[model samples]
Target: MGDTNIVGGIVKILETPEHKTFSANISVTKFRVQFPQFRNTSVVHLTFWGNLARYVADFYKINDYILIEGYISLRTKRISSKVISKSKKIEITVFKVYPLLLS
Candidate 1:
């Protein structure tokens, strides 16, 4: 079993989902979702492959609260320019998303 189940409001939609085709004609859609914490908020980059990608892109909108169940992983990237820099990122690989409606 994995160690991640997150429930939060969608504070911002970083980018609209876009479809990309890779080797073997494998297709994927990627987007970002922000979850506000008590004092600080965390952003999660998400990728949905194939049908789920299309469904989420069409069905979900900004500011919609959602419950996400998935696994968490850390991503690191190097930024190079005048000075070399390293950036660390946290992302959730979403298995399921449940829309939350508040009364």
Candidate 2:
């Protein structure tokens, strides 16, 4: 468990939500959201699963502002083969989402 809640605009829907069936036909939907940092305008990544993923895919689009409640996770992935380099990324797993209506 982590303490992380984020409010930002949707920069890009990296991938549309899709349902995948695992062993025994257990299903889940997953998608990604990109937002910007408040202070420096840097980008952040978010992942939504199950119902939240479906909702986000149906209602959200690029450049839409939204408030998300979730936990942050630090992920490390191998990015290079020649040099054996790795990259660290921060991702948020969303539990709730709200569209920010602007007038």
> Among these predicted structures, which one has the highest lDDT?
1
For model 1, residues 34-92, the per-residue Cα lDDT tens digits are: 76553345677776666666677777665665666666677775456433356767666
Regions of model 1 farther than 4 Å from truth: 1-14, 23-25, 78-85, 101-103
Q: Please give the TM-score that candidate 2 achieves against the real structure.
A: 0.59
- Residue 94, candidate 1: Cα error in Å is 1.0
Instruction: Tell me model 1's lDDT, rounded to 2 decimals.
Output: 0.63
Model 1, position 28: C-alpha lDDT score: 71
Q: TM-scores of all models?
A: 0.64, 0.59
lDDT of 2 by residue, 36-62 (tens): 544344445677766666666667665
Which pairs clash inside model 2?
A: none
TM-score of 1: 0.64
Once model 2 is optimally superposed onto the true structure by TM-score, how far is the C-alpha of residue 63 displaced, in angstroms? 0.7
